[model samples]
Target: MSDSLDSLLATADVADRRDEVVTGVREHAGRIARELALLQGGDYGSRDFDTDSGTWTVKYEGGALQYLRYDGGREEVYVVSAHSPPDPEALAEALRDYAAFVEAYNAYVESLEGVLDDVDTDFPAVASTESVAAERDRVLDRIRAVSGEMAGQLHRAEGTDYGTFSARVDGTRWELKRERDQVSYLRVGGEGGIYLLSQYGNPPATDVRELVGSVPAFVEAFNERVADLDAGLSRVEL
Candidate 1:
């Protein structure tokens, strides 16, 4: 019964942020069903009115709980599901849990915004001396080491050809690529560099040019810091 309901819930489009909370609710439902022997089977069902349209369906062997919110079209903003029925108290608890999960998720997103703000405010000025070139070299070396480590980790996790991993350190832009003799880029960027992993067949040069343009500002800031550090070191009497 739990397995069947879980399978169905997996197909439901729970937004990425709410997926973990919905999964937790399903687990709680399975526990309740086990205690109530609802696994024996019956057509018992119920409906509830709340922030959204809620439907609970109990099959003879198991059941499913679904919530849907629609905006007068084919699009649904929210959908969540569980595999077992809940008593009033249990339902209340589930709602509370879901609410708390939402709060935490919102907080996490806000924290990311704060991080971006900090990065923007603290970006270093680019150096204007020969030391900038030396700093670029050092930063490139660090980028290579870190990229290699990341590639090794990905290879262990996904068993794919991370071998094509390469980094191009340009002024304030650091571009990393994992390419075969093909195209289709899987790109991610952060405060350190832009990473592109591609597996699609021979793409156009335009794709590569567009990727370089999309390099994140945080990565540029990091390169600027490297240049600043090199300039500072060169002026020191050490």
Candidate 2:
């Protein structure tokens, strides 16, 4: 071949080689983007496209990137396009970064698996807390206060005629009765804390109690109130 023709052929070969390099890197970038897209999960109108060059998927979107560009505080990952004449070394570094990022994210997800598994499978777990116990105690207090007050008031009001009382409040059904020298009372239904509130004058000063659940605080309060009332009753001339 003539010198000029040979030179033209060589130049064409060089252009083709340059095109290959650019095309190869872009295709690689597209593959990386595709992997990222899969990792992203939820559909942001993501779709993989294939052409003669290769397959590639959008990251966010060209428009989204444009909007993010002007936002001073916004930070995002960007990739060099093969069309932009990507440097081979830069592309390799980017691939390494993507691999590391994927690995790191996968590790984070694996770490969370134990928590998720517990959440999904572990049932009847010990969810009770001190706060819960306190709340239960409060409910018990309500039962005690209401039953005691009603029992006391009825006993005083009956003035020897106080025989029996039955009432319901906030889903708690209660009954109070007097037997000879004893006052008996009961309340049921409030946060699973009530069984029976029957009482009989066992000791000379106060009534006996048969109740449910362990709420020492409320029991103390109720016992104090009833004991005081009984003491006052002992003093009255009537």
Best-fitting candidate, measured by lDDT?
Answer: 2
List RMSD in Å for every model shown. 23.6, 18.0
- Provide the TM-score for each candidate, comma-separated: 0.19, 0.23
lDDT of 1: 0.41
Q: Where is model 1 more than 4 Å wrong at Cα?
A: 1-129, 162-176, 179-238
Deviation from truth (RMSD, Å), model 2: 18.0
In angstroms, give how far residue 3 of model 1 lies from its true place. 99
The local lDDT score (0 to 100) that residue 24 gets in candidate 2 is: 55
Relative to the true structure, how large is the alpha-carbon lDDT of every model? 0.41, 0.45
**Backbone clash numbers for all candidates listed:** 3, 1
Candidate 1 residues 19-122, lDDT tens each? Answer: 56546755654443342344334434432223232223211123443332212122223323333333333344445434444444345445556454545566
lDDT at residue 202 of model 1 (Cα atoms): 27
**TM-score for candidate 2, residues paired by index:** 0.23
Kindly report which residue pairs in candidate 1 clash with one another: 41-60, 42-60, 183-200
What's the lDDT for candidate 2? 0.45
